[model samples]
Target: MSGILSEDALDTLFRHARTHNAWQDKPVSDETLYKLYDLMKWGPTSANCSAARIVFVKSKEAKEKLKPALSAGNLEKTMAAPVTAIIGYDVEFYERLPELFPHAPEAKTWFNWSKEWAEQTAFRNGSLQGGYFILAARALGLDCGPMSGFDMKKVDEAFFAGTTVKVNFLCNLGYGNPDGLFGRSPRLPFADVCQIV
Candidate 1:
């Protein structure tokens, strides 16, 4: 509770974080990856179901498996990044709800083996954790490249053959090459984007 980022640190986390498309050849150490997970795991989840599953692609063989699945335009960037994470969601995430939501017995029933309910909870909570992953990566001084332009079936076949984890998205991460970035894109204005309700 005593640990908190300085104002400058907080600003840098939000302001400097960008959708990186290019990366330096430097490797992302396992230590840093572990720390990134540690930071992100603290973010809240519904019933603490914590459904997100991450597969880090760094080996040449793993990257090769993913290459044919990517859009032609995205292949280069996806291959170039030091690590590409296959973010996934476990369909049986509620099995752990007993520990996560210890006070509530009925919570586990919400995300049980029923496909419809399980799919909804897994996708919703898993996507929330994905956002947490990006924030944690930025806070740890890593760049992020998030994309939805890949073949989901190929990805699932390659990474989740015998598992219930379904692919959510792909994220390429490492140190970014700022010189290679296009101009910063504009965001929707707050006036047009939010409601005071």
Candidate 2:
């Protein structure tokens, strides 16, 4: 429960978890996936709405169903990875507001009355949770390849029909093949990117 990682260890987790393109034919066991979720689920969300939903695609059939939706560049790598997570947001997440925010009885009713507000909130928070999911996967020693090169409508129609959960993004997970990585990209310096008041 107390701090488990030293500063150096935490920094190493960040530096090493790059977007890996190729996998080693290794599998990410179900226990490891569950542990990753256990770590990620506790990350902060607005009003504890906890709306992010993850569908782990591991079966050959499921991956086949997803292949046509991906861009050509992503199809092979995605299919090769041990798992491709379909990250999504539950649009009607506010229905649980009464339980998530019991002290505020009107919270659930506030969003329930407007489908637009519900959708917007779901998109915002679900996106945030997706970010947390990436960091969590990295911390758990899994390589990630988060991608946007896919057909969202087709993905949803194939994997999420008849559900409130709408796909936000896709991530492939497994042991990274170091040979497949491109040179590390650059980032703006803090001095150039930020300003003090």
Q: Candidate 2 lDDT, tens digit per residue, 1-197? A: 68688876777577555888999988999999899899988888878888898999999999999998999999989999999999999999998888987889888876778888888988898999898888888888889999999999999999889988899999999998999999999878999999999
Count of clashing pairs, candidate 2: 0
Error of 2 at 119 (Å): 1.4
Mark the regions of model 1 whose C-alpha exceeds 4 Å error after superposition.
Answer: 1-5
**Model 2 alpha-carbon miss at residue 132, Å:** 1.2
What lDDT score goes with residue 148 in model 2?
Answer: 92
Superposed by TM-score, candidate 1 places the C-alpha of residue 121 at a distance from the truth, in angstroms, of 1.1
Clashes of 1: 0
Q: Tell me the TM-score of each prediction against the true structure.
A: 0.94, 0.93
